[model samples]
Target: MNETGIPDDPLLLGIDTGGTYTDAVLFCERSGVVAKAKALTTRHDLAEGIAGAVDAVLAKASAPARRIGLVSMSTTLATNALVEGQGGRVALVMIGFSETDLTQAGLRNALRSDPVLFLPGGHDVHGNETPLEMERLEAEIAALAQDVTAFAVCAYFAVRNPAHEIAVRDFIRARTDLPVTMSHELSAQLGGPRRALTTLLNARLIALIDRLVLASDRFLETRGIRAPLMVVRGDGALVSAEFARRRPIETILSGPAASLVGARYLTGLDRAIVSDIGGTTTDIAVLENGQPRIDPQGASVGGHRTMVEALAMRTFGLGGDSEVTIEEGGLSGRIVLGPRRLVPLSLAAHLHGGRIVEALQKQETRPVPSRLNGRFACLSGMPARHATGLSKSEAALYARLGPEPVALDALILSSAQLAPLDRLVARGLVSLIGFTPSDAAHVLGRQTGWDAEAARLGAALFARRRDGAGQQLATDAEAFCERVMARLARRSAEAVLETALCEDGLDGAALAGHELMRRALDGEQSVTRLRVSLDRPVIGLGASAPLHYAGLGALLRGDCVLPEDADVANAIGAVVGRVGVRSEAHIGQPQEGVYRVQVAEELRDFPDEEEALAFAESVLMRDLHDRARQAGADQAELHVTRDIRAVDVDGSRRFLEARVVAQASGRPRMTLNHD
Candidate 1:
């Protein structure tokens, strides 16, 4: 048995649901990975893909369902949704704030027409309460409940005292069935607008994460795997599925964090730059002394900076399935890859074989290529109910779309139709299918498992497009495919370098594109030869890492390590991770000799500074220990740290404030025997 007292080789199942694929791995601590499998992710019904991968892995390992002791999963679904600006609508309730406050922290931009209400309620820095006005909320609760999937409550200075926020949350729960997220529950920091923004996002993701957890639970039950299901948080720590459902915003970098953990475990690397290339986004982070760095400023995804504590990772929108576009009005016709993803033509043809092939073949035979030669649109398989809030134009365009792919040239006869089509795509009701890096890989034979014929045809169509100089973009299909692959490599290198430069406190974005940096990357020779390189190797992880990162080492002037089973690293990390929880309390002096201690929704006054500090630490430890258990830890060990602030006045020390933090960490509880 291991030190935790469980069996040494208990079989564990790990699952990772990503933008394009769902992967599963069966692992044993004593034996390492037993079996691994992958399946195309089905967004409409995630269970389909989950079952496909899990069943495949189980069959490959020759293991019965009941033998599994634990099941853990990590996902990029929440991250992708925010990056793509797709989620259920939500209502924001801000107490003790005005319309002017929404302008802070990009909160107004993030709201984007979603309902927001401001009321008179809040607390001071020393936990003094402000009268809460809830008459307006009570009157409009029923109407708001009908329009939004969830609600977010943020009382000004809620971190000082959560009484107002809790009161509003309870009121909402008593009136409506929708989930309500309180800002204080998300963060104890004193930034009201930022905390509210975080709570707003968490509210938006409630239904999405809940659906995934519910689906996973039902699927596992059907398979007779009665193991405790855990979820990987953005910090690479494990938490109960229920915990994740309430705070899905914390899962923004879940998949990338898991990949970092898996990379460290697989390569045993002390320090390396890890880049994980997935279909929708490429996640990059650094491992310092075998640990991923935590972002003290909170995680940022899409364009909104949030208050979610996640790994210090940069997510770029350049990946295998990134949309391939040619820069307009440029004589050289330089290619541009996405900040947006597309369903690759190869995968489309593989799924809808004859029809996809016929469409591409017909497009290839055209005398002159149109701008929309190889583009198609189809339903994204989201349920019809989610198609609400569409404009008349959007509804009309959405009506014409069905399960089958429709060529954009035929579907969009006028330029006016383009905007509606884009709106539909943004709403997640439709997906655009086009030639992407994945199709380029297929054409060049660097990747497989999809229709190469469709890729070749799509490449041919793209090659025939004209540049500003009236010359063809490429001589032939293979040449165009090669150029596409080369661009992907160059972009991937820049992404890695940009991340490294940022970590060193430089302007990574601007420097990565600077002429000197460009020359260094391209190995340009001149009278003044320049060179730049990384101090350590780069660990590349992803299904297509081998193909995409083949030349990354030479470009970066460093070694690139591609470990075995790197493709399923996220899943592996999910199973091997431990559960960790943290709680904090603060002691602030409202006046001389009066210490006000605030922790876990309670505030009390103490005459002595030492007494207040002791009370804060005790409260923090008790709260964190219970939280650790609820987060899935079997038996957590607790640690406390103190940060006291004071100033010397007249050669005597005066107390200002004290912050006490408690941390609990332990392995997840595993089943000892089949029930």
Candidate 2:
């Protein structure tokens, strides 16, 4: 798309992996975005999704993948695996730390099993530990020769010296040739158990990530995309294919990061609330300085908590696919929505001239698939009956549905609700299946979702005149519509308040005010004022933002910043993020009856302390730079930060400690990468 002849500048291809789809983009230095495409995500073979996106985009641009210089991929595989608990067989290897240390915050009860192997050898606050316990360590390595996919070693104070951790690592490499990760290698942070958990998570995700990258690289190859691949991390940084595989956990928030990228590209507004609408859900984030706000608590995957820094984005189940239901006693529908993922039940319900889920509930309850069942603690509070009329597929999916009581809650945590619920009808779960997400979108008078009959049914259903109810209908459809809207308004307002800020102090009024302030002053809303009541204007985003948000925006009195390509917001956002990484190390000592400290790099064995520090600094800095460059960073910088902590241990005062933490970042590589 560039006017320049032969376009000498590198054309970066960016790929973002999302829950539902994989998005690809061709970007240039000066010409901005050239082409983009989206493909449904493949949970089984992730590369297929990337390949689909690549082929679609290249087909549009009439370009070959080989011509692209570099490829950067930001994915949700690690995040999803953790969130979904789908990572393959992995073992946790804890060193020199107690079982008590394993139960620390961020990762409590998340490990599949208790860690194996306990050694007496570990460093003190200063990386100086009792002499090595080589004999015991060798025996431990010998013991783990079989099952483990990889190894993670977290010693008492490896961050200080890493000698013990590295030596043990060397022993691991010599014995098993398995992927080895040491606490000191990843980050120099304290908390042996927390560090061990991070390593365990990384090890667990290795194979999955390797497959993802390999699949991605191969897919590009099929499309003649011979460029090297880069992957995005949770911290909004890019790492090499090799690096990302070893640390897949870093790229879990790739979807939101990409959206942040798109937001940056279109509006150029750094401070604002960026709302990304997907077919199934809405993702909201506060961006300060052109990036999504980073959560102070760190990245949370599935229920397992990890300290991978990421944008502070809040996700909600409220999306286009959210179903609207009415209760029998109420003048209108009870307006049941999610905490559970639906499969276009609304569309299916509409086509059947009834609520499919409700109807199914009326008929019988069944278990959903293993994939889905575990996510929800309970279904919609409905009791399950024997499998009866359902097929294995249907039953499996249903068993996963949990009890009817927990349905909405489960939906909130997953993507099932946003699925084409009408698919249920197609599969004959319901007597008369209806429209899908596509169908509902069209019927709702939106731009996306191409179900024609669905559109008709939705319009008629919402209008309350569908199915030829005629004059015989119990009540006018308009009255029903009004009632439904009233309930929906209340639910939407409540959801927004609860999600944005927790209950208590964060009332609807406060939320409305915050929303208004965030949107108007911070450029989050198209409307200048927040709606005090449901009657006020409300803004919206997603595949249908262009078609639907305007009216809502007016209601909420806020401005809307639609992406240049609003339809593929999630995909675009997936590809629009930066690749980054963070690491920290610590050491402690007590000076003259007082705890005084210094924290630094592990390679302090050099003759000059400054030189050792500088070299160690260079090690991480250059690693980050090289990592950034391999993915095509014209320029990059290393941000090295140091913190000193003085803690009261016992009574004595000696070299109590020192600690160092650093992060290196570079320009996001451009490449159509998937996985």
Candidate 3:
């Protein structure tokens, strides 16, 4: 489709489903971005956020939902389900390997919650194996009916020879008709347990994403939008809803990736670190060659370590809503939110009836005497406080709240069982961490001409904290933010290391060494789909309100453009996605004779060379078609690979071997069920 063919003034929706908020944006096809909005993330029903944001953006644009011709959504639903331990119950059926295989690399931890089921069937690396007992497996399945909501079947060497795995899957389908994930169907990696772990997590995540997509569909319907819906993927590409359901893991980093893509599209630059600080976290991504850097190992969800492909991004918990507590003069008061974010009732101030200095004055009225009672406050260099008269309670509170356990993580994640009083207490802290609407406005630079002082004062009030808290607190806010950033950088580097190099040989000490991660970050040189684009300018989008935008645009230090409707970038992003299908099949020989491999796709051959190659090509195309069909793809375009290897035994003879893997991707409108 021609870009100009789209409506000049039409609204294109982009939606970003983050860990904390679902933001939406409306971009004018003619003038660029037009409007934006956000809604509280509805964990109970994701659609709530989507609908809320969409309506808000529509209102902002003074347009109707029917005016939108395209819609796209980027979600962390699949990824979050895995990470938050909220996926449906799942069964891991290992066809050939035993439970013993799970002992390596803490594999046991990966499969901890999964119900492990062993079947008497498996194949060798070459696909040859002892046949499984159909009757016995059927009986086992019959009994397993009550145990799990989904099934993940991983046959030994299934990718090598999928016949047994296929047969078992067919059997399970015939019996239960449940959602089933096959190892060969998911990836082509070599590790059995790791591969199995990937499949299991995928299957488990299915239960949650199915609902997420359904909710999203319903939300679009409410807006009167009936466009062929697609979801943005982690690779900065797009895929169909049906495809998303089967491989939800791919969407783990969808939100951040979409922003990176938008950034590149806006500035047309690459090779810079994109730092997006939101309400709950700060996402740092490196762009190379106009793309986000994809984590080679793929980030882990919860702890499953699924290969949900995504750009390498560092997520820091320090956000608009982080907890803050100041132990002062032996008196401890938590800001609850964060040193930066200030809502109403900053912890220490909240404890003083929402007044700014109640907690500190209480210390002043105390009978006890301490050295801090007379300490002078220093900005660059000035007297701040004197702790000499701190009371016993206040002093002990200071010692206990001396900083360490940041309160933000706990307040936002309030549990149901916590009493209202406790929740209130937690919320006071959360508000301090969470940015208020005014603070948000200030950060986004929207409040520039209006009232900067008012915004800062409002921030102080909502946060229940005064500027002086920094003087009395153990550490300054800027230093605290830096500390959070450093930790995030370290963690992100470690995740990247595992992907750049295999984790098999790393020892405990090596894993813990910060220097090792630093070295890895410095040495990376290869290019992957997830590239960070620092070459071109980065375009920043979001509703930081007033605070983040000013210093932020400067920090970006490049040609940074904000969408006219930056707040709802997600809604526009949601509408920019597409449906895609991919198929892969490997053909090889493990032993001397019978040379064969698996085939996928609908075409009768290996694409261009198939008719010439005849049988081999035909088989190759079928597997690709098969996978496309399964992925709900209508037609497929193939990008095939043929890997030829020459192997020599240590002592003597050399042999030539060819391993063929064929892949095809296509939109899902034509033969949507080809796979």
Leading candidate by lDDT: 1
TM-score ranking, best first: 1, 2, 3
| Each candidate: RMSD | 2.8, 9.1, 11.4
Clash counts for all predictions: 0, 104, 131
Query: On a 0 to 1 TM-score scale, where does candidate 1 land against the true structure?
Result: 0.95
Write the candidate numbers in order of decreasing lDDT: 1, 2, 3
Per-candidate local distance difference test = 0.91, 0.55, 0.54
Which stretches of candidate 1 lie above 4 Å from their native place?
A: 1-8, 84-91, 112-115, 137-148, 174-177
lDDT tens digits, residues 267-339, model 2? 6676656666554456666666666567766677677556567777666665544544433344423345443
Highest TM-score against the true fold, candidate: 1
TM-score of each: 0.95, 0.73, 0.68
Worst 10 residues of 3 by lDDT: 374-383
Query: What are the runs in model 3 whose C-alpha is more than 4 Å off?
Result: 1-12, 27-31, 62-67, 134-136, 325-541, 549-573, 577-581, 591-594, 601-637, 647-675
Candidate 3 similarity to native, TM-score:
0.68
